[model samples]
Target: MTSRENCGYSSRTIFAAWVQGNFRIAAGCFWNTLDEFESAVDESYSCEAAETYKQAARDCVAELTVKLNKAGE
Candidate 1:
């Protein structure tokens, strides 16, 4: 049988998907940081920039928890 057919929507599949989605979010955050670094001539007043990054990180964690809980059912 194929892998999916054998596993049949197992928790492992759910966890893997969750991890993949989180990784994509992290990559986007990294790119955002790089973009800011290249464009920001002065690093002394990057409070707004830091806040955006922190929000994105929080969102990713929240999403991951939701997905994992849903998968448990």
Candidate 2:
């Protein structure tokens, strides 16, 4: 399943859309990052770009994966 967490931001939006199960068209900020990517997210959470939250989630998942792998070992 695909999930999304929206943060209050104006010009900077971490937008990405995709169908969960099979294959479908991906839109928004997912495949459309480099086109107009910028530091448009919230100023309080200032960082590089709008992909900050996304990268954070990815890093968390990666850590979980490594932990699970070690547990399985």
Candidate 3:
């Protein structure tokens, strides 16, 4: 769905920002990804696909949180 497509774009943007040493930008993108997942969950509360996207978003947030902490963000 559109949510999945948007998540992919966000992931790519996050990767690009992180590789360029733009921690803030990367963090922002990660947050955006989370937001997308949250919206998807609200729109399709009982959908298995929405749950999967939410889990992926949570995993990304957890991973990025560690990196952000290390970077003093």
lDDT (Cα atoms) of all candidates against the true structure: 0.33, 0.36, 0.44
| Residue-level lDDT tens digits of model 2 in 1-73 | 1223543343333333222321221224433332222332233355544466546434433454464453343
Pick the TM-score winner.
Answer: 3
Please list the residue runs of candidate 3 whose C-alpha ends up more than 4 Å from where it truly belongs after superposition.
1-33, 44-46, 70-73
Candidate 1 lDDT trough over 10 residues, lowest sum: 1-10
Tens digit of per-residue lDDT, candidate 3, span 1-73: 1112243323432321133343222223243344554674557455675665566556555566675564455
11-37: candidate 1 lDDT, tens digit per residue: 111111233233222231223332343
* Candidate 2 all-Cα RMSD: 8.3
Regions more than 4 Å wrong, model 1: 1-25, 28-45, 70-73
How many angstroms is residue 53 displaced in model 2 relative to the true structure, after the best TM-score fit? Answer: 0.8
> Looking at model 3, which ten-residue stretch has the lowest summed lDDT?
1-10
RMSD of 3: 7.9
Candidate 1 is scored at a TM of: 0.35
Model 2 earns a TM-score of 0.30
**Candidates ranked by lDDT, best first?**
3, 2, 1
